[model samples]
Target: MQDAILDVKNLSIRYNGASEDAVRGVSFTLGRERLGIVGESGSGKSTVGRALLRLLPGARVTADRLRFEDVDLLDLSEREMLKVRGRRMSMILQDPKFSLNPIQRVGAQVAETYLRHFPANKAEARAKTLEMLAAVRIRDPERVHDLYPHEISGGMGQRVMIAMMLLADPDLVIADEPTSALDVTVRLQVLNILDGLVRDRGIGLIMISHDLNLVRNFCDRVLIMYAGRVVETLDARDMDAAEHPYTRGLLAAQPRIGGTRGPLAVLDRRPEWKEGSTP
Candidate 1:
């Protein structure tokens, strides 16, 4: 079995001035493989992802245990956490437009990201950046290198974001709806790039998305979340065997291609589950 790359235990987070916890006693383990997290918006899915990286600002984070590679994340000082963030663990946000600097050339930004974590010379970093851009299937890496973020299409920008993150050579990547804003074709292309990255690099991935079909096809294991907690987890191959009502409801909501159906099934809305109750 692959070794555990992340271990979260009784983790909780509450934003400042919020009456309710965004995440509550959430716990799970990640191995060196793909683990998909599926939940609708406002389900604290993104909160969990940010919390893992200690990226939640103006929020209180608490956990009995949060470990990565036997290192206790909760115990690390901010200075120490800085060393871990981009080097050992990285995240790709939904939109690269907001993530990438508008003024900087894409290539320079990517190279800078690499240099932040590694002691490589300028020539080495630039070469590595070009290679990463090519790895993400960007056409004409040499030309694209000098282009600013605004000069690129949405898909190209996203690819640049991926190239930057990958340059850190992170062991684990948290991709939070990484393709949510892209067109259908671009979405697939990005997914393919991500697929190759995981396969070739042997890095673990936590793909957080509400797209059931994508998760079903791409992930090795899946976690179904509602309200701030995991309601079910199953092997991707056994997703059809999901036992929770919420999981079934979600699956039923997806329209099958080439099949005529009535209005999409509506999910039953319950009051968000309290922390002490069953998910």
Candidate 2:
């Protein structure tokens, strides 16, 4: 895409002492679009997300070209990368329990991002925090602001986490199974909030998830990964047209409510699929 904000080409990553790369030759470009990456456990979904932000401390992350906007992400110094994180880019982690500070009040933690990137006073930061909390559809932002992380419900915590990451108006947002811990209603609510941000704010989104149905209905494009590589890429509405055997197997494995009453399909892994796919 000519308007691409992120370009990743020939990317591969391997942890120290590992014989093979955990993520092998992953390549894709992100415009102001919602791109979904779906795969089973250990298929390098989250690994790819962390690799982009250079969060894999012990892993060797390599790419021929990994550029975010005008900057080369792979070549940046850690100190320089820190400037990009939160201000230019943000990551909404999987669970609120782990992502949020247990002891910090909700408002202070959300306000920290605003204070870190901008020259803002405490009162200004608090206003922005409360505004963002309300923006995410939280009721009674003033009361929730002073509450500790442990004081909120799981669904509310997800909203607070979204607010904290988005408080600075980042250009790119990486959500790693962001709603895995929520119920059906809360999941849709959180997804709607993300959809609005991508639509209204024009921020590029990469949603790393295992739920095919979620990505099918939510994302614009879908990347199907198997054995640490993207096996197929297609429009989310065209998942049924996937050509890869692994992709087909995944589609077959998901049980439908009113469809067949027979047993769900089991994936038959093949070693040939371990090789990297051509871009």
Candidate 3:
């Protein structure tokens, strides 16, 4: 943790007039490694990621400590946050169709990040954009750069999103369900590209996902969330050894190859599970 890029402690978020918190007392430190957050829908996994980036609108975010590198994110004004957002940290959204501009060419959108952060000439930004497109394993970077978001396949769009987010070489990247929209083969390809970037650049990655199997295979550590709290944290390889009943139920619910066919087990909800416990 001495080389931690992001340190979050006692983080919680709630929308105005909401009866309960969406995320409560979640705490973790991220180093230059892949960390996965997994849970069912409405389990507050994405909310935690949004809170780290201050992307949740009209929501009250509070934390005893939420520091990215040397900067305190909670204290920075909205104007100042703009500088930190794409330069030091970036987010890859769930769907590129919604995140990317429909009208703008792909290369232009990628170059926009470079132009915003650095005082580079137009020619220089274009060169960097092409270089990044190639880095993400896009076939024929020159041809793909000229295509619009709609013209490319889902897999290519996600890779473009990765290329855009990593244009400035951020220290921490929060990817929220980045591969959820792709097919199996494409999903693995996208994961490979993301993994390569994180490893080669030594950047911290927070992958918010609902796929337990993918996280177990792709991430270094996993955080099991329930309701609004982190119920358990363990090495991704040791997910099968999870002690919490909620975690156990999730593993049971997953369909296994060559296993007996039966109805998936339902997660038995418990009130005590939301009592803000940490592991």
Candidate 4:
């Protein structure tokens, strides 16, 4: 963590009227590397990412240390945080169908993002926007730029989302299941774009996903969450050697290609596992 971009220690969160904490004692430090957060739905994977950007409106969030680069996230006002978002930090949401503006052309949405962050003319912003679209491997940036969100395929819309978020060259990116809507081929292509970002731009990336195999192969480090807590942390390559029962159960639960003809193993819930788990 010599040049860490994000640091969170003992981070916990609860909803407005939750009976207990939804996320508790989750902590990790991120450098210029791809870190994956994997868990089943409702495990708080998305919640932690939202908490970093103060996107969770009525949730109670407490952390001993929540620092993005040199700025303290908890101390920033809404207006102050706006300068950080879409400029220094950005979140690539899961679905473009809901995330993108249905009425506007994809190019204008991306160009508007660039204009908001950088003081540039419309022509200059459009040029930058096209560059980003092409960077994500869109075949015809000029043609697709004019299409509305409804006119594009899910995978194409996702690429547009990526193009928009990356327009400003943010220091850190939180990608929540970025490839869920894409096909196998498109998913790999999108992942390659993100991989290029980490390797070439040297930016920190947090990939939030429930697909263990995807994280294992794509990310450098892995954090396995269970019941809103990080039950284990390990290098991506060492996922098979994970010690936590929850992690092992998750691995065992993955269906192999032509290997498992029987039902997948079910994860047994244990009370002790949730009481004191930490990464």
Candidate 5:
């Protein structure tokens, strides 16, 4: 972990007046590799991502240690955290419609991040914005650049979001259900772009999703989360060898291409499973 870009330990988050923490005792280190967090909805996977970026408004977040590079995120004020958000670290949200400005042109939105973080003039930012759009494999970047978010398709919008978030070449990128909006073909394309970013630039990536198969195929490491805690963490290729019952159950529940054409096995809920127990 000496070269880890992000180190989080005992991180927890709770919304106002919540009976229990939304995220509990999550700890993991992200190096320059793709780390996927997999769990069902409301499993605190997204909460962990938001907590890292300090984006959980009106929520109490605490951690024994939360460091990005050499900077301690927990100690930084909101104003100081702004300096780190887009330049040093960035997040790709699940949906582009909610993440992007409906009124602004896609090119302007992408250029805005580069302009905000770097001392680039309008022309320079625009050039870099078009370059990034092309980097994400968007055809005719010129036309897409001037189109509004509503004018683009879901896949294109997601690509625009990706272009904007990565314009600054952040050291860490947290993607929450990044490819969920695209078709299988577009999903692979987007995944390839993310893979290239990590492989070529050495940027750490945290990919949050419920797709076990996708994570196993695309990521270097996988963290299995249940309820509010991480039940297990293992190499992506070793996911089938996961010892935790929750992870094993999840793997079994997935319908295989040539497997029996029967109803998927139901996940048996166990009270003790939520106690942060890991086999």
Candidate 6:
């Protein structure tokens, strides 16, 4: 059996005054490998990712077990959590514009992140930040460092955000829609960078996304979710062999390039309708 890096059992999350849990009875395990979660909007995929980082305070999260590196995440105090976050575990937000501070120089912000976890001098921190920038394939690291968030392109801003997250040398990275904002060509480039990071650093990754095709190509395993519940899980390479109706529907909805589908099969939404629900 693979060594478990993260084990989440029967995890559930409920927002204040919500009729039901946002995440319902979710359980999964991660080794030192890449795992992908795919679903439509409001599917609780992002909620599961955020809950692992303890990022949602107003949302109640409970689990029979939520352990990272054999430590119970629920039991840690805020101070203790600070030591673990960004050092051993980190997250990349969906949008760089909101994730990054608009006023801070890119280089200084990244350098500060490095210094927070590493006992380094200012010069050392600056050097490390520049190295990380180069590692992410950014050209002119020096000039880019001095520029504010608005001065860079969306793709470059994303790379800067990634550089900051890696500053702490985290073993696990949860990337939530890391390439959602990029154009098709740029999206592939960003995914390539992420692929390199996982392969070269042996960092465990939980990539949360709504794009089935992207996850199938970029990840090792895939979990398909619907309405806050995971309905299917399979090998990414074998996603074509998925058995669930919902999974099959998602695959059928994709438009093929060379040919036209006769009917363009519509997903059967009736299964989602409950006794009193009108959706």
In candidate 1 the C-alpha lDDT for residue 205 amounts to 95
The runs of at least 3 residues in candidate 5 whose Cα sits more than 4 Å from the true structure, single-residue gaps closed, are none
Point out where model 1 deviates above 4 Å.
Answer: 271-279
| Best model per lDDT | 3
Q: Which whole-number lDDT from 0 to 100 does residue 102 have in model 3?
A: 97
Better of 1 and 5 by lDDT: 5
Q: Write one digit per residue (lDDT tens) for candidate 1, span 1-279.
A: 358999888888899999988777788899889999999988888999998898887899999888888678877889999999888899999998899989999999999988888889989999999999999999899999999999999999999988988888899999999999999998999999998998799899999999998899889999888888787888988998888778888998889997677898888865644333444
Candidate 2 TM-score over all chains jointly = 0.97
CA lDDT, every model vs. true structure? 0.88, 0.91, 0.92, 0.91, 0.90, 0.88
lDDT of 4 at 53: 85
- Winner on lDDT (2 vs 5): 2
TM-score of 1: 0.95
lDDT computed for candidate 1: 0.88
Model 6 poorest 10 in a row by lDDT: 270-279
For model 6, how does the per-residue alpha-carbon lDDT over 132-202 read when each residue is reduced to its tens digit? Answer: 99989998999998999999988998899888888788889999999998888888888898889777898
lDDT of 6: 0.88
What value does the lDDT take at residue 149 in candidate 2? 91
Estimate candidate 2's alpha-carbon lDDT, on a 0 to 1 scale: 0.91
True-structure lDDT of candidate 5: 0.90
TM-score of each: 0.95, 0.97, 0.97, 0.97, 0.97, 0.95
lDDT of 2 by residue, 71-177 (tens): 99988999999999888888998899989999999999999999999999999999999999999999899999999999998889999999998889988999999
Candidate 4, run of 10 with poorest lDDT: 270-279
Cα RMSDs, all models: 1.7, 1.4, 1.3, 1.3, 1.2, 2.8
Per residue, candidate 5 scores C-alpha lDDT tens digits across 120-234 of 8999999999999999889899999999999998888888888888889899999999988678887887788778866788888899999998899989999989888998999
Taking all chains together, the TM-score of candidate 5 against the true structure is 0.97
Better of 1 and 4 by lDDT: 4
Q: Candidate 4: deviation at residue 265, Å?
A: 1.7
Estimate the TM-score for candidate 6: 0.95
